[model samples]
Target chain A: MRLASKASSPPRRRQSFTEFLGRREVMPFLLLVPVLIFFIIWNTIPTLWLLGLSFYRFSLTSGRPPIFAGFYNFDSILNDSAVWLGLSRTFLFVILAVGIETVLGLLLGLLFWGSQKLPGRRVALTLLFTPMVLTPVASGTFWRLIYDPTFGILGSIFRGLGLPSLNFLGDAHLAFGAVLLVDIWMWTPFMVLMTLAALASVPKAELEAAEIDQLSWWQRLRLVILYHGKFILMLGILLRTIDAFKTMDLIYDMTFGGPGSTTEVIAITLYRRAFEDFTMGWSSALAVILLLISIAFTATFIFVLHSRDRKQASLAEEGA
Target chain B: MTTWRRHLYHLLLWLIALVFFAPVAWIILSSFKTANQILAVPPVWIFRPTLANYVRVLSDPGMVHSFINSIVLSVTSVLIAVAVAFLAAFSFSRFKPPGTNFLMFLLLSIRMLPGSAAILPVYLMYVGFGWKDSYWALILFYAMFSIPFSVWILKGFIDGVSPRFDETGRVNGASWLSIIAKLIFPQVLPGVIAALIFNFIFVWNEFLFDYIIGGPHTTNVPTALSTGLYSGGGVDWTFVSCVTTLYILPPIVIVYVFQRYLLVGMTFGTVRGEV
Candidate 1:
């Protein structure tokens, strides 16, 4: 069928020498070329350069060439107390936020899928969707106000309940949780949207079959809905993981890397090192490390997605 | 389930929705309070509403200029992105261009590289060309980043459009441009609208690029509010809330109007890929 369609398609227009100069197809590429070249030169080159610079004794100010110091930067970061602290905090934030978002997202998706007949479904979704749309700076500003230790809404609420007041941002432990809380609050809706879309696409007859088979709600979900939704859920988790790692704006505004680097994720740490501390070389090294980590995470996701896809294909063939 | 269980579900949904919206609700409420009253204990649920902060911001000279700059930058960049993506999508869908898939993969991969990673090199290039603080530098860069999404989504939309219409136009001796302007344009209007709205929101929400490139003098609303210039620590909390409300207005309004299209556009190929 694909071959038949391709054969019947119109012959693609060839470029005549004189008219080629005036062709729209060529025009499109001509316009697109400079941008592509610019990305290649600036974006692609600098990214690769960071890998090289990570090993060298690089300096931004002196204009000295990067010396091949052979993993000195990596070794230093490994040995440094602050580096371990930042790495662990970053991992904790990602795990906690992704974990919470996945559970909450599943629950919300169930609610959305089951509550389709409910009135005000759209209204509920619109409200739930608002936070995800808000810019991180705006969210940060709003949350920072709420985090005000003495006079904030949170404090006032706790006081009213006769509970001990908490310094959400001022304290170290709370600061980490506070950042993770904002992340979960902001992104859980995204997870809900993805999972809900997947759930909505679950084969209805199969679900009904499960229902007729005397399966409980949990069984129906596990056997029918989840079987179909698993790949998309994996996709959602992988996307969120990579994104949470790169999250910088909210962290910057909310904590400024905090009461002393308590909430400092890699992005925040890299920004401070490069901009505030003026250690360009070290910052570049940190940036490269973050890039590699994200790439690895995404690659693993692709592998999982592909395997799931293959499994689904076989399942379809067997049923047929 | 009984009626009571149904009511409980409704209540649970309402509570979840309220949790998601509480911060926004707080900002809107605080916008109406006086500076001193904003921090009032028990958080004044009922109080005399005031537009003093809005009045102050509206009358401020620099604030108005920054607002204009924000609107201009966002609209212009989105326009450029949508226009470029439109042509590129047309070329891809109609004429199978050389290396099209690779080109698309390359374009989408730009999104994977974090904005921070791109900033250092792009900044160096801009500084080299003495384009720092120039509107063109920021607009061009923003449009470049915006293309991947516009292309991906619009390509999906265009793929749904049949090629018979193009053949019909060709049989009638109509040129490709005319056919696109008339036949394809009308059909994919929703796609165009969705892309425009998404691009607008994306550009408006962008901070890292705006902060790094816009510098101190050119303050986008997010940067201004974020780096709130509380030199002596007498921060205007109410004013900040008011600023947040105003900053959020454009996206909210756009999203509200075109929400159905937004949903379809975002979920298009993802769910429907099989069917």
Candidate 2:
């Protein structure tokens, strides 16, 4: 059948020299070469350089060339308290922020998904997404203002309610929580948007059949919504987790990883090592570790997505 | 659902929207308040709105310079990225070039790496080559970073366009460039616009590269706002609010105008990919 259809398509034209140069196969390569070259120069070379730097000891200001130091940088970083703290804190922040955002976003998505025809939905969506779209530095600045203990709105509200005002970015735990709040505020809309898109795409027949069969709310959710939305939800979580692990801008603007390094994620630590401390080799090792974690994440995500797709394909075949 | 329950749900949705919007609303409000009123203990709720903050921020040559830098950097980078990505995406979609999948995976993995990972080496290279603090440094870097996402989005869009369009153009003796440039490009223009908007916003909001590599000549809005507000002797609430308000306005406007494409673009076309 495929061969018959392929044979029925338009025949190829006579090839002039120019046409041969612009052949369908050749043209794509021509168009893609610039981008590929840019990628190689900007991404590939730098990445390889980073790898090489990770195996050497160097400082930007030392005026000495990098010296080969086989695994020394990695060994020191693995044993460094600050590195461990940053990694653990990053994991904690990702878990808490992404977890809350996902749950809240799912609820909001369910609510708004059912209210597509509601008046003001457009305005509400614009409002909801405003946070996500704002420049992170700007958002961090505004949030810092809002969290100001002296005259910020949150402080005023707390004090008005007969509660003592809490220093949001000054204390260790509160600072972490404050950062989590900022992340959730910025990203929950992402969760909502993704979830709604997934929910909206659920086949109407499947939904009607579930309803006609009188499935309870939980069962309907599990069998229909969850089944259909699981992939997208997982994709959302995966994207958010990876981004959260790289959180630096907001932290940099808000606290500079301080009140003592309480909120320093790996990105900030890496930044400090390279920029402030000028320890190029150690920073490169840290960067390599970060790259490995990100690769592990992408691999896991692709693996899960592939398995789920395969499962679905088989189930569809069985159904047919 | 019961009528009251539905009404309650709508109400809750509105409340959620408002809660999400309150911080931004506060920023906008603060921008209009007096310096003293901005830092008022009870948080001045109602005050006569003033244009003083706008007037002040706009009057600062540094602020104006940063805004121009942001516009130039973001617009150029986004345009370059979109053009490059469109060609690449077209090639991937139509030709299904050998190693295309692997190439795409490599690109996506590059994006997955924390941008900070590349900053150290790139920074050193830039300084060594005398490219640091130059517009090309930022423009090229931003364009490079935007390619993977742009390619993904544009590829998804191109996939939606049937191959028959190309064949039709060919049947009419149209060359490959004309088929892609004239026919395919127009069809995918909306996707291109989405990618453009997305890349523009990403570059505009970029902080790390701008902070580390940008200097007096090339400091974009985000970096300027960070240093301008925080590095000074005291936190001038009014000035900070004013600058931030200006800083966020462009993206806010873009987001509002293109909210329809927000999910697909923001998610790097993953949700659309599912469809």
Tens digits of lDDT, candidate 2, A169-234 = 888778988988999999999898888877976788999999999999999889999998788888
TM-score for the A chain of candidate 1: 0.85
Model 1 clash count equals 0
The most accurate candidate by DockQ is 2
Candidate 1 structure quality by residue, lDDT tens digits, B55-117: 998998777877777888889988887787877777776676787766765665566555666
User: How does residue B215 of candidate 2 score in lDDT?
Assistant: 85
Docking class of 2: medium
lDDT of 1: 0.75
Residue B238 displacement in candidate 1 (angstroms): 1.0
When candidate 1 is compared with the true two-chain complex, its DockQ is: 0.41
**Using TM-score as the measure, which candidate wins?**
2
User: For model 1 chain A, where is the 10-residue window of minimal lDDT?
Assistant: A30-39
TM-score of chain B of 1: 0.92
